[model samples]
Target: MGNEYRIALAGNPNTGKSTLFNALTGLRQHTGNWAGKTVSLAQGSVEYKNKTFQFIDLPGTYSLFSNSKDEEVARNYIVFEKPDVTLVVLDATSLERNFNLALQVLEMTKNVIICINLIDIAEKQGIEIKERLLTNRLGVPVIKISARNKIGFPLLLDTIDRIVTGAIECQPLVLQYPDEIEEKIRQIEPHVRAIVGDHVSARWVALRLLDGDESLLDEINRLITLKGAS
Candidate 1:
């Protein structure tokens, strides 16, 4: 079978993420709990330009660094399965809080697209996000969409096509930290690189290590070891 691109819909709770997923796939989603876990998983198909995608709706969570099984399920998929794209559905009205999760995904992989949902609500509340500015800052394409009203989806799907086809590169936001922190990232990068796949950015993992995030380190190290064995 030809490759069907896989996408993970992830973001904070109540960002209209489920609404967006429903809107995208309508009633076609295959629902089940994540493997060996109780948290629900919604997988569906969306075809555009004669290309197909398998959308995986991750359980809503504030961040990936959680001990909760819901959070663990979401974190494990992105880190291990390494989906073709991860569409982070964030609320535009609350970018700062939503950004925390987006930053976490950046550490996992570059195949990320930030969907700034609730743009209409933000406008009504007089909160404006300079889409171009945010896109430029993150070095990734930012497609603003009001999922309920179905705005900018055509472009979003087109962007997804380009991403999965490797027609364009996804440049995830790799934020800068203090000089000392940068030194740590540089120190840990080589070790991470030797173990992890080329698809994941080691510098991002390095920062996670400096922050003393054992879950992430252990996860990456384990993935690398598994990849080595195979």
Candidate 2:
């Protein structure tokens, strides 16, 4: 078999996320419901530089806090599946609203690339994004492109290639919470790490637990049970 890499596409609704997916995958895609969930998930594969990149288009969500089924499915996939690289699509016209999800994803995984879509629209509105500054701030590769116009796709693909092949290392920005929350995370993170043991992000899990996320507690117990059975 040839080398294959799994990439997760995540973004808010109406951010041109689906357009990007269709452009890359074309006819080689399928839509299906997530296991035990009614929310639809689109998946496709595209060949790039002798490598197969399978893209899982996660349900459009504004946040991964599991407020809805879409959020739950998207959050679970990133937290559990642990794709080779997570491509977070953002709307250049309204980056402030989009950054909420981007920051959450950064907390969950370090392998990420922030793709600023709809740059053409933002440019028409006299908005100029400092790509280099954003890249340095987020500590990850940030590419600006108009997915509808096929602009900057070559660079996007090459960036993905580099990330997948370990040519480029992504150092995602870590968020700092208040001192009280940080103390609680410090106390819980070690226990989470002992349980998950690098299977997932212990710090992220600790934050969820602190938020009183009962669903995540169930998931943690389930993971422990599965490991015991294995």
Candidate 3:
């Protein structure tokens, strides 16, 4: 598995994630529904710089906090699968709105690359993103690309390869909630760590608990119950 870098493509709906996937893999791709749900997942492979990169295109979702099937699929995969890098595609025309999902993903995993997609459309609409400013704000590599036109892919692939090969380091900026919420997270984090055992972000788990995410709460309870039984 280490021989090939595993990448997860995550983003909001209409962010051109599929287009980016198709552009990367061209004809080497397959699709199937996520098990137990009707949401579809697409996987593709591309060879770049003597490395094979496997891309998993997750369902489009506005935010991971939502209980929708698409949101669950995207969130669970990032948390459980722990891909080498999660390339978050964002609509350049509506970046602020799309940043919500990007921030959520950043919470779950530090390995992230923000692909500000639809540059051509943004240009047409007289919208421009200060890549350097945004990159500084996010503390991650931001690649500007028009996936439809296949622009900026060489840099994108090079960045992905560099990050996967450990040539480039990414320390993503984590979000800070309100002081009360932060206190609650600090309280819940240790329990989450005890249960998950570093399989996922304990801080993110704490945030989810505060948000009343039933799926995760149930999982935590189930794990605790199993631990007691054993």
Cα distance off (Å), candidate 3, residue 192? 1.1
> If both were scored by lDDT, which would come out higher, candidate 1 or candidate 3?
3
Q: Considering summed lDDT, which 10 consecutive residues are worst modelled in model 3?
A: 32-41
* Candidate 1: tens digits of C-alpha lDDT, residues 1-230: 36678899999999989989999999778987665455678899998877788899988999887568678788888976788899999998889999999988987878889999999999999998888898888878888999999998898999999998889797776678889888888888898787674756678667667777788766666766766799
Residues 1-230, candidate 3: write the lDDT tens digits: 55798899999888999999998899999886655456678989999877899999998899987588778778888887799999999999888899999999989998899999999999999987899888888888999999999999999999999898888888889788889999999899998898788878999998988888998776557656866899
lDDT score, candidate 1, position 82: 84
Best by TM-score: 2
lDDT: which is higher, 2 or 3?
A: 2
Q: Write the per-residue lDDT of candidate 2 for residues 53-136, one digit (tens) a residue.
A: 999998899999998878988898899878899999999999999999999999999889999999999999999999999999
Count of residue pairs whose backbone atoms collide, per candidate: 0, 0, 0
List ranges where model 2 is wrong by over 4 Å.
Answer: 32-40
Q: Give Cα distance to truth, residue 122, candidate 1, Å.
A: 1.7
Q: After superposition, how far is residue 226 of candidate 3 from its true place, in Å?
A: 9.3
Q: Which residue pairs overlap in candidate 3's backbone? A: none
In TM-score terms, candidate 2 sits at 0.96
Of the candidates shown, which would achieve the greatest lDDT relative to the real structure? 2
Those runs of model 1 whose alpha carbons end farther than 4 Å from true positions after fitting are: 32-40, 197-199, 217-230
Query: Can you give the TM-score per candidate against the true fold?
Result: 0.88, 0.96, 0.91
RMSD of each: 2.3, 1.5, 2.5
